[model samples]
Target: MENFDYNLVKVFCSLFDTENLTETARILNISQPAVSQSLKKLRNIYDDDLFVRTSGNMKPTIFSRKIIDNLKKSIELIELSLNQKGYNDNLFYKKNYNIVMSDLAQSFFIPPLCLLLDEANLNIDINILQVNQLEMEVKMREGKIDFAIGNFPALKDNINLISENLFQDCFVLMIRDGHPLIKSDGDFNNYNLLSLIGVDNNITGHSEVVNKILNKLGCKNKMNIPYYSAAPDIVEKTDYGVIMPSFIAKKYNFHNTFKIFPILIKENLIEVDVIYHKLFKNEKSTLTLRDMLVNNFRNR
Candidate 1:
């Protein structure tokens, strides 16, 4: 049995593949002096030069030949054992994860998210924080949360984060029930579109999308309000209208109130996506949560 410096194990592997120190250094991106130092350390550990220089190819010494296969096999077995244990670890079953999203995501995606988690029987503490899209990624990296689900307009091209579309929802014109303007035939022409502002300033994306859709539909006139309330709130106060996600409209019965009022546009839908860092891809609990959220929207 040869005593070995595990630090030299990778260097030996590189040498074995290349069979030349210059090539090994180039491949390993190390100086020749560093490679020589590693080789000397390994030789001392083995009590033998390990490789004999001859005809520009380093031939294995008798001592090296005797133990190389055993060394390789041992390393292989250790790696396999580590991987198998990793797959079966209890980490996934015993984690508390926090997630961030808009208020709307809670209303739409949470029920299904909970159902999936319940099935997993995981004792996870989930914190769903209300954050605007701009604050989401930083919150994830800062450990303020583990995941985020919603619109991500600020994602850069360099971002290597992972995201999946949970579901697509179209923008809809929302109004109260029995609004006189909607009573007339094609009365959509007379109604004002509402936008929630101030605390509800996040509606700008929906507002712009609605405008583009309405422009295509030839409905040039639209109004907006910026009060902070659910898309359902547009119905409680005045006849003022709002452009909102079609799913929220449908979920909250806004559709029945004023009708979909055809946007007269070609494109009517936008997707809501769930996002997380790639580093969490291997975290079983996070993956479990991700699958649950996806299935929740998928099955719906």
Candidate 2:
């Protein structure tokens, strides 16, 4: 193992996780040819066919399988040692931080978080991606997402994740101010007469919960839109309404164009949590950002 290239080992581990040379190269920011060459070198060094190209994925050999856990543990240790320098105020200046958030959460959380960053004099580059529950753990493990903020139903009891409760949001009925459903102030007289305009939750993981709320409200008809940002305008134009989080509804109604009414149903509130992998539980940047988010939104 003289002059062993750790980069080749990294490519091997990444390939093991992703099962594709193209994907592994993408994750490591290298060329596909480079990945192939590294795999070739790794095979020569180990004197075994480490991985085999099948009809689908590049399946690892039994030898590779036996060492996968040790390789992961070694990589984790290296990362932990590299990040041992705890939080420093100067570390955040002009650095890029990626966060995974639901569209609804992005709408209401980013603005205030930006304000906090400004106040702290930190010129951090904040990037927000739409949350995908299925790939969240993978993304976090790969450090593709620094932090994830949203109501994650799949991660509620996931042992791999550690979460902090930021706040709880209840369901609200959002309608244009002059809609016929509103006969008077704070009164929705024709709730069932209007159809619902719902944001599709294929990626957001809120469809089941939202559907249950609509069922309780006796809303029989609904139209699904792909994005939540478009829900407000559609509700203002048509007789259709939206059942959304209280925070989003309040933020949307801030200009008085819409009215937000409380849901008259039991357990309508969902706890929005900030989640990260346990591996990063003690990392400086992760802690600093998580603490900032929790403190900013805990009371609001």
Candidate 3:
């Protein structure tokens, strides 16, 4: 085992079939010299002339044929174990996956994502939890959380976590269709009169930026909700309006139930990302879920 790296085994298997160093290198994505070095190591380990150089090709010797079957089986097992996390018929059982999601993700991302997961025919449990930016690192380190989605300010430069930006979202003022502000010809001069509703539980940084803009505009009345999904109902009955992500506003504001208006003030675009710890950097399940999120929400 000391002399046997998986790389050496891979080179051996490729060379066994190709019999040409150039062809083996091409198949393995390595240089010809590297393949020659691996063959030299294999020769030293086996103490046999594994291949005999012929006129146009290298032919495997009788010793090579004797051990090739076992070597092939070993390589197959190694590769299967390496890719064990990939979804398959047996692994997709009643397993629970806990994810930390934001209000925006809950309203705009969860429904479509759940449907996609269900389509995979996996009886898996999904637990979507909420965690603040300051607490995300701790929870991920403890392995109490699987992954998180949203604009996490604390993880922007954190080296311990790996993140992929899915999309950019901007804040929009969502109001009921027949609100007085809509009747006022889009005039926000009286915006201070309406109570401002904001979802701030997920710590996506949108609320902070929007809060500052609301303050600058002298809109004193404010209400903070734990979930963004509740804002649509709250605004439907009352004169309250919420500043939410553009994607959420568009997805939930169906049936002309709400009107979407850009935050007249220049608001910073929030970068939505799927974040996980470095420990799961190469884990196939994490990578699979990340790819799904990118496909579902990435800017088209």
lDDT of 3 by residue, 99-186 (tens): 8877667766778887888876566678988777888887776557778888887787888788888877787788888788665665
lDDT of 2 by residue, 189-209 (tens): 466797888777655556767
TM-score of each candidate?
0.60, 0.67, 0.67
Question: What does each candidate score in C-alpha RMSD?
Answer: 11.0, 6.9, 12.3
Q: Per lDDT, what order, best first?
A: 2, 3, 1
Q: How accurate is candidate 1 locally (lDDT)?
A: 0.61
Residue 129 of model 1 has an lDDT of 72
Most lDDT-accurate candidate: 2
Candidate number with greatest TM-score: 2
- As for candidate 2, its clashing pairs are none
Q: List the residue pairs that clash in candidate 3.
A: none
State the lDDT of candidate 1 residue by residue for 102-185, as single tens digits.
666677777867776576566678887766556666666444667777655454221646778766667666667776676456
Worst-scoring 10-residue span by lDDT in model 2: 85-94
Worst-scoring 10-residue span by lDDT in model 3: 85-94
Question: Comparing 1 and 2 by lDDT, which wins?
Answer: 2
Going through the candidates in the order shown, the clash numbers are 12, 0, 0
lDDT for 134 (candidate 1): 63
Local distance difference test, each candidate: 0.61, 0.77, 0.75
